[model samples]
Target: MFNGKFLTPCFKSKQPWKRLLSTQPSVVLAMSGGVDSSVSAALLKQQGYKVQGVYMRNWDSLDEVGHCTSKADWEDVQKVCSILDIECSQVDFVKEYWNNVFEKTLTDYAQGVTPNPDIGCNSFIKFGSLLDKIPEGTWFATGHYCRTNNGKLLRGLERNKDQSYYLSTVPEAALRRTLFPLGEIESKVKVKQLATDFGLLDIAKKKESMGICFVGQKRKFASFLQEYIDQPPGPVIDLDSGKVIGQHEGLYGYTIGQASRICHGSHKWFVADKLLDQNKLVCVAGSNHPALFSDTLVAKNWTWIHHQIPTLPVQVDAQVRYRQSPEKAILSQTPDGQYALRFTHPIRAIARGQQVVVWDQDWCLGGGVIDAVL
Candidate 1:
């Protein structure tokens, strides 16, 4: 199944993989049949590492229209591995994903909180169960756009695509054993170009995957979630006037800072908060409503990359969401033992259950879940 022409581009000195030494470490790369992971396998193989591709099936349920991409994705993985001449395998993690990530995510959503399943999947599945399934001495690798140095997670060189935030919850032990081949690449454009040069043009042209895998792009999130969550409709109230302006399918359908689709008025309305106890969806009149921003928030269950909490009241750059510009903030411990992140300037939509990743410049110190927005 090997293509001699496909292997030629990987050896070019100008390729980003050229920086890697010929260490030949045994590596198990998480291949997702996307351009990123496919390129990761190629880079690892080119670096002289003994690489094996493993496709993880995390979600098994079919979409509302009775469709799933797992089969197609596996086909792509096989094609990519064939071109690279590497042994490829598949593993099912559906049970583990449900127990560790999806279950907790649904629970959070049911309570009007927005939990980030990607962070949980990285910590529990990708670096957790997947690591256990691999050979004992094999180094784990993935297509994540983040860097590591001396066991510390760092931002990807491509700032816009930096995924250090999503990986903040991963343990230091996992960080040490993980390899990120795409970390040093200048941009996603370069990655696609590299894929084409590597003779995997079909995979290179694939659209980037987004959102939760189980929720497939074809279905509405609310509709997909309705199947799993018994979301009773609730009132969408205006924060300023305290008026019941519209009705919402459920609190899970809205997140802090999102525009209120159900509300209609001369001015656009944004979700300001969710009064979970009262089962209310609060809205503000304008997109830039003062109620939509907050300067302080509390984050609990903090995961420090070094496994040690830093000095209290430490100043760091923090991000409440992925791809957001980092903001200057102070992280200090609260009386309740939770960490409080106070931004120098007000940040918009600091939602509960969302991750707040902190960075010491480019080094990802770690992160925690948003417990309270103040």
Candidate 2:
């Protein structure tokens, strides 16, 4: 179920995209065997576009006893392609995923930041390596829930399912040639209904994927990180009283603003901050603890959709994570070219290494990694 989910902390784009579709342009569709991609492929083929399905075999082994769902997903991909009467091919990108996404993710975790691997997968793997497999001059399409307006990226029809945040890192060039057949669709339920109406019942019934992409949906993030990053127990300290309250599995095992597993009986504790150098997790008694909110945040690795960063102090709405409602903010460029977002209200747990995508109304202006909070 590889759509636009797994991502890493740092990424940059170099590809330039131009869309020169012929009367019957050939399209290489990333078919993840899910209903979204299946419906996308079917729709593209029906639209008189030459469509071919590409199933990426991304992760073969994950730490000796670990494996991914690529095998099962490939079976579904083949079935959909067969049903659609489109030629399907497989590409092995295990090495590419390991190098570009997984390694950076582990490094970010080690640095005490909860990074988005889905962003890295979209930037480096889907839009980067996969471009190499596609024949030159062919259009690349995906099932992502976003639209492009004359090369400018825009929100999908369904705001709840919009994926422009995960795709903020894709180079403008590649995006110019990208096709999102399901972009205008209103809802996931509607997409599934379309699939069933198109005779793709199995695809419509497939469960939507969650969590990490290559890793199974049920895999615990802490358990997964334990496999790569050392699982040293660290002290969980109360931020209010500066007292050692409990123990954490590891500093990297926690993310800011998330509920603490170290139960506080009747009271609740939320991770407020991580002291990486000291290997300590700071927890606050409540979810709305003052320590959990920040009005200002500094971000790095800025990548604009159209390669344009508006003048400093530009008013825009920003999102620290997917599915989060965009918050009004003043966007400015630090002297170092990093972005500074001063939200109208303090946001809860703006974690370093998470991408903060800025939007002008419905258009995604750009995105960057949160580097600091003020």
Candidate 3:
């Protein structure tokens, strides 16, 4: 139990700050100016804990187009901080992002795979990159809906909305210091109530951001690849004849499951494979391409949060993307410590650079950047 002052105002109001501060633990809130984070900040202040807002300024290349990371978000964050009566600081992570996170992701994507950047942002930037700035004994909290029990990360109360996949890469070292304030709450109605009750309704009804990912409404993967990964122009081949049917701008820019983008005379297409050796982009038209789906995925940059890789025949559930359902799998660990997941059912186009989050049921076992889909 916290030995600080009596929970006079805090216990009465059911604010987390009062609940957490009975032990006098200082807290730093990653305020994004959204209603959820705003409510978090407000509740923390009302409970009388030492609270401050730390907004991470990420790389959106806003100066180039003169937009994005919009002013509205900043203004909203400022308003919330004013209401909460706390100091706000902007932390720069652009350098670390490119050097520590982005560099490695692009390398994986060049070989033809789907990469999720939010994993890096969560594991490295939002958590790993900000440790030193927090005052001694202060714990770090974010607007994430997930929860952690005594430093053991767990799924959120809202199963449909869990972000554990992206957050699955957080190292154990950073996990010990992190807190998730929104872990136990339901989404939508409850979130609105929190906003309405706190007199932040104007912005409370606002839609939440997807995170620091730089994608746009359309598929930005092409542009992302063009900027970071080089794609030499190559021949688009007919799978049967292995003859050149058309041309593609770059072979590295395509994935196993994507077909509509390739201009193959509207015959319908399924990517069979990217043959860098043959310098050809292979596709099957209006038919099954069994080779595209793989029963196993070769995952590199393997990370085990709770413990090291389990012994052979390790039981784990693997997810290719945040929304994908969990798949039963066996992980084979290499002598060098890299691991590959062999799924019971073949997963479609298990791309090269996408992150693979393995779970031991509700507990996020850990994750890593997808190295290859073998």
Q: Residue 328's C-alpha lDDT in candidate 1?
A: 99
Worst 10 residues of 1 by lDDT: 1-10
- Writing each residue's lDDT as its tens digit, candidate 1 over 1-374 gives 21111212212222312113445777878889999999999999899888877788888777866466887888898889889887777777888999999999889988889999998998899888888665556788999898999899998998889999989988888888899999999899999999999999999899887757888867677777787888788898988888899998878888889888864778788999888788899998888889888999999998889866678899999999996899999999999888999999999888999999999999999989998989
Candidates sorted by TM-score, best first: 1, 2, 3
* Better candidate number, 1 or 3, judged by TM-score: 1
In model 1, how large is the Cα lDDT of residue 21? 46
Q: State the TM-score for model 3.
A: 0.83
lDDT of each candidate versus the true structure: 0.85, 0.83, 0.70
**lDDT (10s digit) by residue, model 2, range 1-374:** 12222222111211212223457788888878789999999999999987777777778765333456677788888788777777766777888999999999999999888799999999998899887556666889999999998778899998899999999988778888899998999998899999998889988998887756655566777877787788589898998789998899988888899998887657799999999888889999888889899999999998988867577789998999996999999999889888899999989888999999988998898799999999
Residue 342, model 3: Cα distance from true site in angstroms: 1.8
C-alpha-based local distance difference test score of model 3: 0.70
Runs with alpha carbons beyond 4 Å of true place in candidate 1:
1-23
Candidate 1 has an lDDT of: 0.85
Per residue, candidate 3 scores C-alpha lDDT tens digits across 261-319 of 56666688777777776677888775456766788777777778875546676878889
For each candidate in turn, give its C-alpha RMSD to the true structure in angstroms: 6.2, 6.2, 6.4
